[model samples]
Target: MTEVFENSASFASDLDSKDELQSFRREFSIPQKNGKSVLYFTGNSLGLQPVRARKLVEEELAKWAQYGVDGHFEGGRPWFTYHEHAKKGLSVLVGARESEVVAMNNLTSNLHLMMVSFFRPTKSRFKIIMEAGAFPSDQYAVESQLKFHGLDPEQALIEISPREGEFTLRNKDILQVIEEHGNETALVLMSGIQYYTGQKFNIKAITEMAHQKGAVAGFDLAHAIGNIKMNLHDDQVDFAVWCSYKYLNSGPGGVSGVFVHERHGDNPGLPRFAGWWGHDQDSRFLMQKGFKPMPGADGWQLSNVNILGTAAHLAALNIVLDAGWQKLLDKSRNLTAYLQYLLADLGKTFNDFKVITPEKPDERGCQLSLFFYRNGREVFDFLTENGVVADWREHPLNETSERAGVIRIAPVPLYNTYQDVFQFSRLLKLALEKEHERITE
Candidate 1:
């Protein structure tokens, strides 16, 4: 039988002592509050910065100062191939071959590029399927794609929502909808993990279903790439796009990544918006008349790599690679499970607070979304004032009958420790108590 966890400071300290990755906490510069490290639980929004990021970026700056234009080729780590240094590490993180992955443009930009090539809707199959309430960027991208193709979004876009009274969608229902609309649907685009609920979708199963239905499978993995283990190649996911600023710990507005399956990546006949950087390497500087795309995902590039951003990414990826994927995942699972246990324990004292995130381990990632019966915003404000850094999502009152909000807490394994989880639980309990006293008085 497994040992039961105790809700005590000593227990948290013991767990920290036994943690294999405990030393990694020192590698990141944690934000301070009242002369102490703030309890940060918002890696899903923006990850903490790695200490080595400054050194890596400065090296490129020095090269730029000394070599100027020659920095493209003369530097030790030439800007010409700067992105390549990070590709191997990123591919390992997303479970793709190096050639299939490229560190490039922002998330939405890559999504647009992928849709241009994959969302080729004919008159017969003009519909696009996606989750209801997907991240707004995806909604806009799909709507614009339909408009760009001279189709009406109201007629061509299909959104699959949860059953009445349910907070999350079921896999069976999603597959059924795909099967029913297979003939008319041209694309199936969804998030690997829903941002609001922190619910992890079955990517492999969904991809297989889309392929069987003759539609292309693509994912916006902004919340999934570093948070969960994915097998995009084996899952046969046609393409994927993710931003690096979240769980990957790159700086804010960092470069993003894209994955195009080998089948489509190597095909020179595939249509894409082209530029000089994407041309054949040998003839790249030949001032060539014809646009010849390089093989694999690199062929989709429009401009040269952002050297400074790539340096930050390389620094962060090195930490992830050195720690190993499996070890990080194991820690993530345990930390989340511990957080869930604490929340459930706290629920006994506060009947008004409920956890909406899925209870099953495989169904969710590290984030736990909490729904309060009343004064959700007040509680959020209380926590924020008390130095708990978390995210809050409020539903528009006009769109729904009742005003609702969810507090999202993500305890990342790379820098977040057992003590952080314990501190959050303690602070949350105090905040709820204070709020309850205010309401009753």
Candidate 2:
């Protein structure tokens, strides 16, 4: 049976009262305004910090102080294997074997490493296909990789874009591009969920299509990880990478992670930029190095793990693992749906904005990106002034000079309650009405 959603504070409070994971909200330190918790909704940008994160970092500091260099091997959570602490949680979240996942490197750096092994561009198959408006960092990485291979991006890059009048790309269109360029495509790298539109691409289907075209398939999960449940192992994704600061609630620039399918993880002969830490553990101290990599994703590490950063991540990871990944996803869908329903209802009488994120729960996550047709900047500023911590962007609409402002609101299930969503809708309605009055007067 379809659940009927109502736009009322009492209804929202009732939903919050019944939420099984409501207790988890106390685990985070929500930002304050006017001596009350702000309507925090930017989890897609930077997640609220976990209450335990500070102590986790301090513990690592104390360990370093006591053990000195010996901390590498002598501490409770030794720095030598600090990255290992994250594997269990990372594996469960991304749906890969622990051996196939590793906590290491930033998102784009890992992307370059994966490309080194997977994007072996040949004379006939040299084109790299991707979404046109991928995050700029990914775009720069792909462009540089092509140039490094002496291939001009104009000739070697295929960027699939949304169709006319559409804000998101169609799956059929994406598949069609892969098939059409099957002979020439060497790699297909895409965002698991679009950063701007909040559209969750079909990782399994995209991987299947890339394989059909004899091209390597990989994803940047910076926006998808911790926000959505993935089955990358069963889906046979070649590799993937993501940062932990957003949905994972780790601090800013926290250590990122990578997933290499068992197929590639087992292959040590794969070409990659090597480093000392990536060497086989048993022989790492021998220092007479031929550079034998640790098998699986651990083989990709380029430096001694950043103990402090990984500690903060593990602190946050503990909360999600306790909450259960599936349970968090369940609440995420409902929170996004309630917000969507309420916003759509408001649109009936006040039609100034459009929700551009995919309507299907399966095709999106907790985020809803609003494309304002009028009074966008004013309304967004008003929300910010009123303590709605949201994200604002002016993204390209199509292959034209025109662009539109987007306000992204992500209600993270771990720390956000239904009452928070209710309060946001209330603020949004007031912002809109106030803006309308100011313009008319």
Candidate 1 regions exceeding 4 Å error are: 1-3, 396-403
* Candidates' C-alpha lDDT: 0.90, 0.91
Model 1 global lDDT (CA atoms, 0 to 1): 0.90
Query: Alpha carbon lDDT of residue 250, candidate 1?
Result: 92
lDDT of 1 by residue, 1-441 (tens): 114788888988888889999888887999999998888999999999999999999999999999999999997799887878988888998899999999998999999999989999998998999999899999999999999999999999989988887778999998998998989999999999999888899999889999998999999999998899999999999999999999999989999999999999999999999988888888898896999999999999989989998899999999998888888898999888888889999998898678878998899888899976567888889889889999888853224524368899999999999899999999899998997899789
Lowest lDDT block of 10, candidate 2: 395-404
Q: What is the TM-score of each candidate against the true structure?
A: 0.98, 0.98
- List, in order, the clash count of every candidate structure: 0, 0
RMSD values for the candidates in order, in angstroms, are 1.4, 1.4
Model 1 C-alpha RMSD vs. true structure (Å) is 1.4
lDDT of 2 by residue, 98-176 (tens): 9999988788888888899899999999999999999999999999999999999999999999988788999999999
